[model samples]
Target: MSAIQIYDTTLRDGTQGEGVAFSVEDKIKITRRLDRMGFHYVEGGWPGSNPKDLEFFRQIRNERFRQAKVAAFGSTRKAGRPADQDANLLAILESGVCTATIFGKSWDFHVYRALGTTLEENLAMVADSVAFLKSRGLEVLFDAEHFFDGYRANPQYAMAVLRAAQDAGADMVVLCDTNGGTLPTELKEIVTYVREALEVPLGIHAHNDGGLAAANSILAVEAGCIQVQGTINGYGERCGNVDLCTVIPNLVFKKRLACIPEENLVYLTDLSRYVSELANKSPESRQPFVGTSAFAHKGGIHVNALLKDRQTYEHIPPESVGNKRRVLVSELSGLSNLVYKYRELNLGPERDSAEYRRILNELKDLEHQGFQFEGAEGSFELLMRKAYNGYQKPFRLETMRILTELRDEGHVYSEAIIKLRVNDEIVHTAAEGNGPVNALDAALRKALEEFYPVIRNMRLHDYKVRVLNEKEGTGAVVRVLIETGDGRKSWGTVGVSSNIIEASWQALADSFAYGILKLKENGAPDAQAP
Candidate 1:
């Protein structure tokens, strides 16, 4: 619906994901981004839960948010405590957030077993929490925890709980799939019923245990809910909440529901990658709308069709989200795929030319040898340039050596020496590190840093090693993908070898080469992204 609102819980529920721990500064940073992105609500955190969240509220007070309303989250008052005096409710008020959300029991079982209180007391807790918060000039939202399960068990009690909230003046009453097991159809039915009965605006907060969080949220909207609460990338406890990245695009484009301005949607991919980088997690390459591989074409027939009409392969234009179409080069690639790549890199070779055939054949040969060019766009570009432009090699390797030793106290140390020739000059360098790969990388960079000082800005971000054939055991050909960033944009290079060390070295060298080439071309291509 055009009246739909986007509520982001990334700072609160998102941190519940394993290995996700955002500092107060990080939360504030993300909050500012979301505000600029035009989210209607930003759930800061539970102030009573941790000092970090409390400090976030105090710190965010001075920062001006153009659009987002910072919301503090907490549970309803305890069974015996008064709403104004309860520590949890008081914390929400003291946080100075204009909006507060209080979660109360909607399930009969949790009321009797967990709270050791009557269902009537749970209802009082819900009503009083909302009413009390409203009296303090706070706009309150009430979360009916375990709403779907409670509805499935006793629809009457669930309705009563919602009525308690509605009568108490909550701005919105949210249905929570706390266990995340409800099917999309079930969610739709429950929400339809709630929408038909309640006069208050409805919201949906779904978890993705069944892989249906996004589907359920959409269905809930179709069934009449007007607000969607979710986390970026679906980051949360267990399977995470519905990913707003997927939901926002789905609503704005697919469903024709106005949530944010269409122009702002172009920043969707940029925001997704930015959030993942802040969390120090790689963006899922296959994630629906914003992932690297989402718009990538690999199969021969697919590429042929896509070249004629992208709609044959892509549901939406990649540029809609600030992502470009990627034609992955591999054994499965067809002539059309090579043509696309050649044009993208400005390689002056016609699709039917002999030079095009030569490069395509070489690519096939490389793929057969365990080279995965799909993730190594830099290496693939270098290959094309060398084949067609007679591009001179930037540097020559003279010699390299690495030694690993286990010393006293069970400590291990690695040392490396590298020798390189640049034109008429010879350069040599040595360095020690915690591992063989680290030492080699250090020495190689040291030798090259003098010649290309821009390499100093480049840092290795991620390294992944994959065995091509595990049946060959230790002798299996291994593929290494090294991701490097120069304080801004990141790129990858691939290397393959029977020796892990050799593979790592090849990838490392290519990574540096790619960084240098990119810097020479654009000075700093990624400064605007981060």
Candidate 2:
């Protein structure tokens, strides 16, 4: 019921996730992004662990952030090593950050097994580390590593570890669910007990191995934890940390607790995708709140209710989190789907018109033929426009040929020759590529660039091919979905055919057509639609 501090460790713990890495520049950029979005703390990785993180702290040391304090993360002093002389503790002090977060073993089993230190020495390490950092005038957050597990194993020892840090001037004592296996109810009860026992402010750091990091984090907050530490998009070691993307909104909108600035919530989706892009990973399409399909309606029944009142299907306005409502048309779509799309497009037949019904029937038939429009809104938009009287394609493909050659030395080459009629003028071109689809794309662009020069701005960003019927094997119908972008925006177009090349060409052609229409809408020169 109070303001919850959001501590993001995406640049630190997030990189621990397999296949997730970011350059020092990426860390700086994320820091700036999180600051602008009004996060309370941004963990800048352990300076003593890696050179990149050390370089990040060096570069970001002088940069003044608006709202977030960049904390340098490291573990408490090593056993028998004085906190002042410890390399990890000294690195945190040298990082030039105003805040420091240091973790120490809370679980008694970790003391003897992992650290090979006595229980009393572990407590001394926690106390000495916190006191030394506080003496340096840094706001220290003491992270009780494996706190939940420790409390469950030896409740007295875990409380002693936290008390040592608190009595040594730790600004905040953070409870960590390192293994991410704590149930929500158990976590809530434990955190509530800890809250009553400790005078220091409490924070929750949860992992997602058990898939309850987000839920446990929320419960911890309900039970009196004031801060929630997590990573963007749930990126972290093993399963992941709690996803701040999911946590922030739930706290802000549901619990009526302030996290980030509510106005900044509109940028959450873009931030999630931006971080994913920098991480060089594909965004999760089904991720809650910020995913592409978060607010997408596919079934006809859902669309019908959504058309009347979006609250019937949606929990919140998609725009609130920088997402949009999508109504997908497929074999399952009814009249309401067409009605919603037609209204959104602002160009299609009336809801009561026969043309509307015809288009709906055609959409269903095409989907039945393995042409999916759910992920190919560009193709669906094109279908709606083509339904208009006298609508013509910008260019007509006259003929195309592909040749693939493999030599004895194992070198292979593919070439495409294309002929097109643009404004009734013949354009012939040939191009080579790594594959037949790429060659065809190149050849088509080569022929069209002269007439519709805007085509040069378009490039295929993604191409996915799915076998419609795997049982048919070589004879199976294939569905090709191509995502194309014109620098500013992207759209998906789909095609279906038994021949892969033909299917690729269909999607490719639609992608170009849609790109040109988009360019024209934006007032790009020579981007005329036929």
Candidate 3:
């Protein structure tokens, strides 16, 4: 099977998504990651659009990419302007990129009403832009904006636009569903038409408004399109674009069509998560293939089936995409959950061992009181290790006090005093912060760093608090889920109490405890146990 070219639009189109902003350095890192992962092309941002993009192109020029070719993206020159004299085209040439992608009007409405130009003029703009870029000795891909909608309105005119690009020495003509309202069946038919009408290979760029972007992109490929354009996690404007994470596996594993190198497929999960981290967006757990919950099983029947044969519940091996199957333990979990977890945790306890029963009972009792363990793997792991493996504490908590006051700046300031003992050495520290949690976090670091300086890199990644008993008013029990990270990976710890402060302290302490255990196991330098 011929390989389908994977063109990533993350730096350009993906940034259009809400709350998605990448610094120049971020773009550079992502570009290098994609290149290393063996993507065919990465659509760098348009140099004419922003200074950050210009800087990115400038910075990226000196770096050597592994396999991916960098392509600069911009729109066709303004109506009635000569292609050579167009600032947008000039920016693409000046971007020092070997490839350029230029989008032009395919819909008659955009040509007549939006651009205020004739259909003939729009055709000339598309042709002249492609020819001009190609003349500069650059590979050019033409994006027929809203081609599906245009084809539905005037099939002749839309086909004419694609032919215009093909006649102008374009390398490929990509059909775009700009509004993302087209269905898969419609996209397939139009892609077939393009194959029959023009000699150029087709690419698909579909948005997710109709929840059919991935479907449409794949359907077009099955209809003979050779390239697919999308973002890592479907990051784009509005409903976002088609997710490449979903499409690549489908193409390679299901369709038996090669996209990225087989070895690079294992990096899919990490790439999806890395892009989300750089964008500062929470990874969607339910996202297919690369999500945390993609291969996670919580139900008894599913876990039993998974243990017997992973094929029973999972479509493919999670490791194929750099993901792992997770057996989430909860009220819904059963014996199979324990059995599966033992394989990973290497716990030596038998099915009905005293230690196993004790841990299980503790979990059930705590869960009965509104503690959720499904998302608190770090806390649960700490509990299991201490209960079964005789895990030792590195430090002992002595006492803590908090005081809140109104400052002269009309803001509330919180002060925390923390005392702890490490190896018979007592440390006391006080710190002030904008809030109680922040103050506690600072004071804990101050008191602990003297003994466990390794914790200096640990920081809170996310803090979520939920009320468990709303009817209890101010005395309602609350659950806090604190996610902490030590620069590499993040883990969640949970706590429950009627007093929010006490609950927060529990979770925060567990987070630090987990970190301490990790450091001890890995043998951290300049740290001593109490």
Candidate 4:
């Protein structure tokens, strides 16, 4: 098997996505992570295009990389200027990197219309730029911009551009599907034609406008391309670029291509999540191999079968991608599902005992009331622990009242008063907030802290409310999911009720319960527990 190279452009093209911006610090962090992940090349950014990218190339000069080579991206020289004198070409050469990638117009329409240059002039610009860069002892990768679409429009012109790059001594000619509208079959045909036409090694750079970037990249490789360029988690312009998370695994495992080492494959899931979190973007759940919910089972039958033999239902084992199998409990759960869930909670189940029935009945009742146990397994596990006499309450909630007043201008004021009992002492507190839920949570925490000072470490990280069975309209069932974190561990809890306030209270109560349970398990003394 031949070794395939992986080129990541998340910091460059990925940042071209609207509403997506990365600071220089963010670029350095992502580059370091990608380097450690064994990516063959990392396109930091286009130096000379922006101040931040220029600073990145300068700052990164002091850092050392493990496996990935940094490639500075830019366009070819202008129509009128010589390669060395062209500002764009000179900027790329002085970007402080030995490897540089330059894009040239392959489509004649772009040459005449966009660049306002003749076809021969465009070809001269492409060949001269590559030759000049090579003469300066720089590794030049020529990106044939819009190669696939240009081939469809005029095959001869597109082939002419590739020949121009090859004749100019370019290291590699990367075929780019700039419009991202070409299908896999079309890419295969075009790549095959280009591979046979040029003597230089071929590379692929695909976009995801049609959501087929990964598919098209793999197809291009199968058709004889040796290098693939993509982002870590499909982060790029428009629909995003090819997701290397999917492409790497598909090539190494599915297609049996030799690229990254087998041990490096296990880090895909963590690397994918780390990049998403750093970028402050939510990871796609349906993303091929590394997503959180990719191998998760929610249906009763599926969970049951997976518990018995995961291979019976899974395409690839969860561990293969560094992800664990998760059995989600919901309204569709059965006895086997409950049994598996109980085992995960470390609570032994008595198959035919009344306690088992009680637990199952409690879960069903909670589900009917709008509690999604699957999404709030931390809360479910706490419930099981409390039922098994393993949980100790941190503080007691004696009373909670939310007062709301609507102003004439439609502004609203919400205030809450909370009373709690801790260590045979009662504490009362009040707080004002922008909303009823916020005021209630604030007052509750204030009252608890008055009795147990350690409660100050807890905070609400995320709060989500969903209307269940919306046909009920204003009287519809409401489900609240509260994610609480204390700088270390984070857990989610769920609650449901017809009134939004009541649902929020249920989730808030579970948040405290889970937090207190964790503290007790860690051997921290709960001053309020009796």
The top-ranked prediction according to lDDT is: 2
Model 2: per-residue lDDT, tens digit, 431-530?
9998899899999888888778888888899999999999998999999999999877789999999999999999999998888777877788678633
Question: TM-score winner among the candidates?
Answer: 2
How high is the CA lDDT of each candidate model? 0.89, 0.93, 0.90, 0.85
Instruction: Arrange candidates by TM-score, descending.
Output: 2, 1, 3, 4
Name the runs in model 4 displaced over 4 angstroms. Answer: 353-358, 388-392, 405-413, 449-457, 469-473, 487-489, 522-530
Lowest-lDDT window of 10 residues in candidate 2? Answer: 347-356
lDDT (10s digit) by residue, model 1, range 1-530: 54789999999899999878888888999999898888999999999999999999999999998889999999999988999899999999999999998899999988988899999999999999999999999999999999999999999999999999999999999999988999998789889988999999999999999999999999999999899999999999998989999998888889988797778888889888888978878688999889999898999899889888999989899899888889998998878888888888886646565666778889999999999998888788877878777765567788988899999999999999888887658888899999998998899888877677767788988899999999999899999999888888888899999999989988888887777777777855432211
Off by over 4 Å in 2: none
Pairs of residues clashing in candidate 1: none
- Model 3 residue 341 CA deviation (Å) reads 2.5
Q: Per-residue alpha-carbon lDDT of model 3 for 420-462, expressed as tens digits? A: 8877788888999999999998988888876678889899988
lDDT tens per residue, model 4, 15-74: 877666788999899899888878899999999688888899999889899888899999
Clashing pairs in 4: none
Error of 3 at 356 (Å): 4.1
- Taking all chains together, each candidate's TM-score versus the true structure is 0.96, 0.98, 0.94, 0.93
Better of 1 and 2 by TM-score: 2
Worst 10 residues of 3 by lDDT: 349-358
